[model samples]
Target: MATFEATAEAAAKNLESGRTLRELSDLFTPMAIRVAITLRIAQKIDAGRLTAEALAADTATDADVLERVLLHLVTIGVLTRNDRGEFGLTRIGEDMLVENGKAANPPWLDLNTVAGRAELAFTRLLDVARTGEVAYSAQYGTSFWDDLTRDPSSGTDFDVVMAGGMERRIREIAEAYDWGALGSVVDVGGGNGTLLTGLLHAHPRLRGTVLDRHAEPALRTFEDVGLGERATATTGSFLDPLPPGAGGYILSRIQSDWNDADVRTILSHCLEAARPHGKVIVVDEFATEEGVRCDSEDDLRMLVYYGGKERTMEQVRALAADVGLSVESLRKAADWTVMELAPAEN
Candidate 1:
């Protein structure tokens, strides 16, 4: 009876504490992390300046305020405060150091940069939620894609973020599928040829082509990977006809940026290019039905930034059918779903 009473008391305390409100208030944590990253706090700490005063002196911030922030970070497991008033990076905080490469210096999290500005537009989520319109354009006075195109530096940053972050995922994709039988493949909208380079590097017998709006970089990547002879990079839109007769065509994480009509159009182009027995491989996140959200914030990000969506498997199959392709198989590689399609029978 005493144990039951204790359990009941704990449950009541949990309910009284308002977990929902706590979670909602935690949104400020990302901004705090952004600020810390911007000030190179982790790097400063790693460089032997362990006290808040030293960190503030190096970062040109107020010592008292910085100490508060550091204290908050310590509570969040990002830093540890010792009895000597020295602070050190926790495992999570270590990733914020610039020396850690992609993991340490994620371009999107650098609040001073364009990607960070884009992320900040999420504060207008209420406006997007009410209007079913993009918050990015409303916040920034221009569409996300337009802003990227207009600002070369920002665009380059965005590209680096996408390419650098997906290295492990690219390796998983390269190894997940059976590329042995495919003689030739075209990577539609292949950004910087990262995926194609991985694929070609893994399968020596296969030749590949990357169709992207930016061809020079893709070509350079092909050369870097030593697949220059076996791979070709062409500048083109995937909405138009692809290079015909490839054994396999790939649309890796491209469909999530467009609406249903655009997705169908891209798939139709792939269908036109794919030989009768050729395969069309789409790599994207699949929404689960059990109300267990995966990448839910990403879906919101897509909606607010590009008016696109992360779709469910059923929706994807329907879209494939509309484009005259039939779902042949599905494979899971990390958090992404690789949906294989073939020409639909009349």
Candidate 2:
């Protein structure tokens, strides 16, 4: 009886400690990730077992700094220490860094790359929460989209990162949703249109318009993916107005960048653009009946970098309802929900 009590109390303590530990872990996060990523540490190990010193020398980074980052990552299960001070990839590290591992996940680490640097701007998150404004704008002196527009390399990397995500997200959608009934679809905030390309491939008859700020890259991606004839890139802000009409709409990974009020504005944009008899599918992160289960580090990471959050399905339903869109079906797919809304079909 006494042992059972002790075990129960320990479980409770672990719950609390686990949450706190998660946030503490966030301190190293994308910086450490990008650090190793920038150095191509995992790639180094793929060749063979190697010492941190040799690895550092080869990568042109200070051995001490690389050692510290590797040790911490090992603590978190991202790297492994071999005999003789050599280093190697842990399963997690391999998933993130191995060549031929994932095509969509690589350019994500180019620190000089737009999305990579933008992700590492943890300090700028404070301004976003404090002022309820765009975090990148105040810190970098321009909007996230604007910075990409000015620099070619940054812009290309950023678009590749987004398109990479689209590669995965589109797979989830095309597999999960019935595509035959839709005549025309709009990918709101679609950049470079690769996701649309994936979706269009699944549904040959469906025409698509990409609503975003810059249409050039998306237009090119569409053409490259062989969806040029059916896909049109329309440059505009979903914040100001979404283009007139569409049978189906996609907002994949679009929300969670703003607080509640801003999300409402985005919802309103979706509402305005959606066809009366149509469906607007929002692909995003959400908590569900299973539980609020993201690791503390991931929670804090999202908080710091994006000034946004993950939400419960109830929260999403409440927000969608408030903006005159009714949740038709919420398909739980891994970490994200494919939410189908139909302007309160009544």
Candidate 3:
């Protein structure tokens, strides 16, 4: 009995130590995954280059180092290794394919890309926490928006990720809201018109407009989505006057990039453009009483990139009230909240 008790305690301590080590080394998996994605290893594996030697030769990487990465991936269930010493894509590994058709190379998985660069900017979180400034700015010496604007390639990459990543969320938002009565809706700060196109496609009767300072890409999106006739792209800042008196106005995932003052200004623009009876839809990450459902890492990313924050429903209500808009309904769509607002009845 004494020996058994001692053995049990020893096992528990070993387990605890393993857990602690895993927690500390959590960064290793993502970095390894990123390297794999960068080398298109999943694609190569899918194409039948399963051995580390073949993959390393094709990718021009060291065979031994690549084998270590493959071994790590196998341990993490991303890849499967057979007794014959062959590696192949596991279920999760398939998602890392560079050409998975709409599900392709998720931006977060490609750490060498712009979106990944944005995520990696979190390394300077200490600077952001110290100065109440964005870590991206601290690291890159430019705001996230400015960085994107200055570099067209990075901007396009960012837009692609945003569009692809938010496609499901956009569908959820469209289905959650009632657009039967609305004739025209404006998507404020709509990037590449992805959300607008989704909403327009979901509601056939709803004609839409994409409002952004750079409307060229959005115009192209409208044309590509077969929404050229039903949608219009207009160039303007949400901080300025919107195309006035639309039946609906949408601000999706835009508020989390600004402080209260700027958010209020944007809300006021939505209010001014929305017809008295029109719906002003604010779709964003809301901190709930149940705790933040949105990615906490993403919340930190917002702080590091734009000095913005995810707001609670109560905070959103107050902002709406300040702008003479009342929250008529609040609905959860995926990880975001879709708050429908209308002019307050005084």
Candidate 4:
């Protein structure tokens, strides 16, 4: 049994710390917000659905439960309630109104999309820890790629998600290297040809190809962007043979999504395709232990989602060496590191 003074002292310290009962272990808050996003509560409120009844009617949810959720959101600073029982969004809530009415947050956090659905695999993280395999298959009964292949719409949604904010990065990458000198480049595993399109646009003399699992979208994008003459799309996987003899074989932001062995295989394929004279240009970020630390939540996401990882610079060099390729040039372009690899001389 503790004395009153000791109890009082501990209580005072807890209060001074301003810690919630379970702030460090809170689970309900995230799911609640996800539920709100799925229901499009913010959009409804933005459209003048001020009361719980109105929002519930719009979302086809029970009014009483929804009112409780709305109040919880108010406590969490996502919303506010007026004296007259009307609800309104706070500034934080406004960020949830996705551009073009698509998602309140990134598609991964929207809960209404496939990316969001895939994120739920994190719930099976313990299984991932024990098996050292991706949890996505355990959670969804199919691999992530297979899931996408089964549903074309979900695959398109994923491509859109990947293309988010890539425009600025593409412009920066295009200017970083003398693409015109390459004459021709292949965007290996390129989705929708966003990067290749930008490169073609930046360097009028450059010809490019988009190689991916789907050809139609990239073909349509190239035609839509009026680069049809300079760009072509082909259906293929990076795990298979790539088109040969291009001046540059680009694996833009691709290596991080594969394990080391798979990365080595991909690099070997690129080296074979780009042999003798061509360069293999890889665009990705490194996980550094020192300085400004490029490590992020994405590091863990790569692991749990796909059995992939964010590798350190040293790991990247080792992977390159394993495939008999040497990094000829390495530079930072936008948020990604561009590494130009060449086959090691005999």
Q: Which stretches of model 2 miss by more than 4 angstroms?
A: 1-110, 124-135, 163-169, 289-298, 331-336
Per-residue lDDT of 223-290 in model 2, one digit per residue for the tens?
77776679889888878868767887788767765568877898888788775777888877664444
What tens-digit string does per-residue lDDT give for candidate 1 at 112-163?
6666777888888887778876777888888776676566666666666667
Candidate 3 stretches with Cα past 4 Å from truth are: 1-18, 21-25, 45-95, 98-101, 150-182, 201-205, 275-279, 290-295, 331-337, 343-346
Q: What CA RMSD would you report for each candidate? A: 6.1, 6.3, 7.0, 6.7
Clashing pairs in 3: none
TM-score, one value per model:
0.75, 0.68, 0.74, 0.87
Worst 10 residues of 1 by lDDT: 98-107
Tens-place lDDT digits, model 4, residues 288-315? 6442235556877887777788877778
TM-score of 2: 0.68
Judging by lDDT against the true structure, name the best candidate.
4
Write down the lDDT of every candidate, Cα atoms only: 0.80, 0.72, 0.80, 0.83
Better of 3 and 4 by lDDT: 4
How far off is residue 162 in model 2, in Å?
Answer: 3.8
Predicted candidate 4, C-alpha RMSD: 6.7
